[model samples]
Target: MPDPSQKRPVIALTGATGYIGRNVMESLIDDYDIIALSRNGDAKDNEEHVEWRSCDFFSFQDALKGLRGADYAVYLIHSMLPSAKLTQGTFEDMDVILAQHFARAAAENGIKQIVYLSGIIPPHEHRDELSRHLQSRLEVETILGSHGVPVTTLRAGLIVGPDGSSFPILAKLVRRLPAMILPSWTRTKTHTIALPDVIHAFQQVVGREDVYSRAIDIGGPDVMSYQELLQRTADIMGKKRRFIPFPFPTVKLSRLWVTLVTQEPKEMSYPLIESLAHPMVAEARQTVPGISDGKITYEEAAAAALDEEQKKQEEKKREQEEEGSKTPSPVRKLKQAVKSDVRSVQRITLPEGQDAIWAGDEYLHWLSRLASPLLHIKTTRTGVQQVYVLWWKKPLLELTFDVGMSQSDHAIYRITGGRLLHAKRAHNGRLTFLQIPNSRECIVAIHDYMPSLPWVMYKYTQAKIHLWVMKAFGKYLRRWKHRSTTDTKAAPRQAMSQHDSTVR
Candidate 1:
């Protein structure tokens, strides 16, 4: 059954599910056999081309599991936008640990080449003043190279594409804001690259010994200011925006503003905001003829990216329509599949009515606080989806989401960063109170979502903990009802005593 002729060189691609990684695999799958790594460990029968590997890079052993039998291990993984719960230290620390493990694994597994994508840093004169994100990227690059692995680093700035961290935020910021309340960071200049260009750069360097253990800066032909990037993006989207550069430094304030306007979490926007303050450009780009010839202008890339995004939206709409047509009913509903595979749903019927159990906003806030002391639950409104940001005090990881509801029914529960890709560790849950038309009693449904990992972790550790929480939640509802009943009884007794005292 084995075909030796068709067997290609295996490329273990970590962060394969990421925006850049997905594009890279799509482009390179024909040339190389690919091992796609996902943090969630998700695999389905219908997934095509690449071989899917489920192990996340959180553990050295677990991360190393996917790299076996591969000729080249692409380090697309990074911790830019960290997920729900980060126990201690910054993302910088975690990234260094991941690189050390990856380097060790590659050395042991006989993987010859290790290609990494990193953030663009300032030129040597200003390198020390690079932002936290850029600094973290440099640290990761340093760690990845220390094991004597032939690591080729492709340092890119302001990747402009669909589903990428940079351009989407810009497109959104322009569309959302009539006037961008810009700051000093807006004037910082940086080189930009198209998605296709970056992938081409990745493909060009395979098995090339000359470029080994060296850093190559990659970007589009055009270099522009951060403010110009914003304006041009706005122009591409057919919108005009007014800009006001504030007097103060924008590193911190810009983060807060982006989040407030776009509903993007600080985990993403903060690093980006910090990086925007620096003038990030390539120190050395390809001077050779063929490599430099293919570069696109920043405006062209933005326009093309916008067009691609629109087409994708149209395609998604068509698919949703087709799916809806196949399953037709009087009360029809469309829903998005939960992003995670680890799911738990529990239902309970309460004796009290939906109104009695369904408390107001104040009560909801109180319940959320009491349910988890670690959880700091807050909400933001996006034009499209309802956003909820949950920060677990125990772990610094914050789960920020844009929760969407189905058209007909709410079977709901749901909800990436760029390359230097990310791992999402989400534990999203909600309680819904329901009242049937005829029935007096109310129904409560508990739905939670998380990533599916090892059998022991999913079945024993995570599932059990979730079940216990659900049980405690039901108990809280029962206690609330009892307290309400007791208060009602005491009110009449107190009223009678007051009347008697007044009569006397």
Candidate 2:
């Protein structure tokens, strides 16, 4: 028995409402108090030993506030699903921003360690050619430790869980499809782990100083191709699913087929299907003690997942019957229907030795010149930037500098209000110019921007124009590399110091 009077350490968990997060939070409750962080924290039920706190990872302030008073943290955040109605960047870029904020916040709050769940990376040679999904995972893993916080990274490939997007999609495909064409990518070998094993791994690692800053590759007892995984799932479910060998690794067709047959959104299926082409088997050297000794096989995992899924469905049905005629709020219904937020992320080459501050200033100056009389940028006395159309007094967009969030390497401008934006939204839309460290590259991104125009109209007009502008800017930057390094002088301003007054 434990000491009755001892205070329990709090473990702050990002993605606390997610599938793995829910399991981990429940399993570890006996050992520690859980600070469950979610976007809709106020709405989440708080049980004993669990406290819900709203956290928007994109916001550094929220990240810091959420992690306060927590001894350790579990980072299970991924930007696969949009957090805003109008997310304006790629998942990879979005993941970068979130990781940076969380890592920095953890450091500021004096968090002892951060346990991150990531995908198993392939060998060195194939890393360069990794799928976007794996690449994003690697980027996140790197960023989490950048703040000097001891990070315990558990790298997993396919997690066999009942509720998550991956396993459920596979289970649905096997149950629904009588016959399937197994593409060449499906032959690639990968490791799988049961959901419980993953939860146990988190239990073992959180606050374990010994495993701090160590990365352990974890998987189940089975090492098999995706084809084998599908077939084994079918066998466990007692279904007769057929497979025809597809000669070509047609990932596009496979993605579509998986989405169509499984009835999962393409957002979930596309990246996963693309990743099947790679071998995701774990290496022997990265394994540690308790986590490596996991005994669940693929078949066992499949059975458990299917059983849990059945139970979940029954529970959901029961709940529906208990609450008859309950309806979602009108605001929620409106949000669901008008979720056509625009997200555009582009990577442009940074001139050697130039930082994000310099790049941002140059962008404004360059845009003013490039668009000329048709589109011009004007700066307010308060340093806010406004874009104007030909002879129009009202600005097309308003960008206010977020001094608190901006640094030498990263510059952030909040889209406070403009004629081109929706009146209300979940988050403050922001434009960021980030210079990646130790590399001649920068990411110019827009996030959570809800366009005022209809989705169809904005997609065709402003969206296309934005892409074209970024592309042209990229080409122009590349041309600077060949010029006499004097282009830096053209920058009209520098990034405000961190101590500068912040503008709301």
Best by TM-score: 2
In model 2, the worst 10-residue window by lDDT is: 489-498
Q: What is the lDDT of every predicted structure here?
A: 0.62, 0.81
For candidate 1, the clash count comes to 2
Alpha carbon deviation, residue 1, candidate 1 (Å): 27
lDDT of 1 by residue, 193-240 (tens): 888888888888766788888788887788888888888888777887
Residue 71 lDDT in candidate 1: 85
The alpha-carbon deviation from the true structure for residue 170 of candidate 1, after best TM-score superposition, in angstroms, is 0.7
Most lDDT-accurate candidate: 2
- What TM-scores do the predictions have? 0.62, 0.89
What is the lDDT for 364 in model 1? 38
Model 2, TM vs. native:
0.89
